[model samples]
Target: MDYVSALLPPVVMAAFFIALVVTIVKSQGGANKAKEDAAVDAALSRAESARQSQP
Candidate 1:
C-alpha cells in the first residue's frame, strides 16, 4: 500500500503526459496546416521587413 501510494502520482502524471503528447501529435498537419503555415510565414516576413527597415 505504501509503494502503491508512492508510485500512483508518477503513474497518473505519465498517463496525462502521454495523453497530451497524443493530442498534440494528432493535431499536426491537418486541415489547418496551410492556414497555420501561412500565418507563420506572414509573421516571419513582417519581422524580416521590420529588421531590414531598422538598419
Candidate 2:
C-alpha cells in the first residue's frame, strides 16, 4: 500500500499529460488547420511588405 500511494501521483499526472497532448494534437487538424495556415501566410506576406517598404 505504501508503494502504491507513492506511485499514484505520477501515474495520475502521466494520464493527464497524455490527455492534454492528445487534445492538442486533435485540435491541430480539420477546419482549424486551413485557417491557421492562411493566417500564417498572411502574416508572412505582411512582414515581407513591411521589410520591402523599409531598407
Residue 34 in candidate 2, Cα distance off native in Å: 1.1
| Residue range 2-32, candidate 2, lDDT tens digits | 9999999999999999999999999997999
Worst 10 residues of 1 by lDDT: 24-33
Off by over 4 Å in 1: none
Give lDDT tens digits, candidate 1, residues 1-55: 9999999999999999999999999989999899999999999999999999995
Clashing pairs in 2: none
Clashing pairs in 1: none
Global lDDT scores for all candidate models: 0.97, 0.97
> How does candidate 1 score on lDDT?
0.97
